[model samples]
Target chain A: MFRHVVLFTWTEETTDEQKATLAAELAKLPGAIPEIRAFTFGPDAGVNPGNQEFAIVADFDNVEDFLVYRDHPVHQAAIAEHIKPIAASRAAAQFVFQA
Target chain B: MFRHVVLFTWTEETTDEQKATLAAELAKLPGAIPEIRAFTFGPDAGVNPGNQEFAIVADFDNVEDFLVYRDHPVHQAAIAEHIKPIAASRAAAQFVFQA
Candidate 1:
């Protein structure tokens, strides 16, 4: 499977409500995008200090499937309308592994 | 389960051999640390430009199990001996979700 993991640092001004909304929006993606094999995401659990504020881990069968989810209108809308507005910094990586 | 996602940007001085060593070293963790439920990691697949250089996604049954993996001497040694030297910047987040 191909896994795409994204780490986000929220802006100081980002509110809890905004983060919650983003989470809710993200939770709906697996239902809307069939290419997504598995998806899990949430805010930091506070286990460590100085960690990124949020993370999303999505899995697909291959790069093509991942690309489908990447370009899907619903995912794009969520990023543009919700994610980009409050994100201070974003770091992402895509890698493949045996399932 | 509690999921830990970490993103790392490699220093320019890092070499392919070093990265391979890191990957090999990380592969041993699941066997050494019983708390690890699932682990997947690799260098960036070049699907997206300007992404972090590498990522590791690990899962545990709960925060306590995750903490065991986090503080395990073998895992810590891998970080100090391999990861810390080449990593220019690191961003991490731990979160929970249903299995």
Candidate 2:
């Protein structure tokens, strides 16, 4: 399986309502896109001082499927409408798990 | 369960050998620290241009257990001896999984 992880640091001006909207939009991806095998996302618990405010962990069958999810119109729309405006920074990684 | 995710961008000067060593040392954590419920780490596949070089997703029973693993001597030693030296940047997040 291939895993895609993204950590997002929200801008100071971002409101709680906006954050909830982002999370709701993100949660809709699995149903909206067939390529996503599994999806999990949530607000950071703030136990770690250096942690980003939000995180997503999604799984796909392979890199091809991951790309499909990445470039899907629904995902793109979420980025443009919800994520991009409030996100101050994003850190992402993709990897294949042999086991 | 509580999940701790960390994304790492390695310095340009960091060698592949160093990265491999870091992965190997990280793999030893579950055995060294009983608090760790699950651990996964690997190099990014580079399918995504914005991806960091490496990522880790570790799970624990709760935040307190995650902290035990995070601050354990073995984990701290590995960070000091291996991870800290070569890592250019780090993005992290901690969250609880309800389901």
Best by TM-score: 1
Q: Which pairs in model 1 have colliding backbones?
A: none
Q: Specify the poorest-scoring 10-residue window by lDDT in model 1 chain A.
A: A15-24
Q: Give the least accurate 10-residue stretch of model 1 chain B, judged by summed lDDT.
A: B90-99
lDDT of 1 at A2: 98
The candidates' DockQ values read 0.94, 0.79
Best by DockQ: 1
Off by over 4 Å in 1: none
lDDT of 2 by residue, A1-99 (tens): 898999999899999899989888888999999988878888999887877999998889999999999899999999999999999999999988754
Off by over 4 Å in 2: none
lDDT per residue for candidate 2 within B1-99, as digits (tens), equals: 898999999899999899889888988899999988878788999887878999998889999999899889999999999999998999999988754
Candidate 1 lDDT, tens digit per residue, B1-90? Answer: 999999999999999999999999999999999999999999899989999999999999999999999999999999999999999999
Against the true structure, what is each candidate's TM-score?
Answer: 0.98, 0.95
RMSD of each: 0.8, 1.3
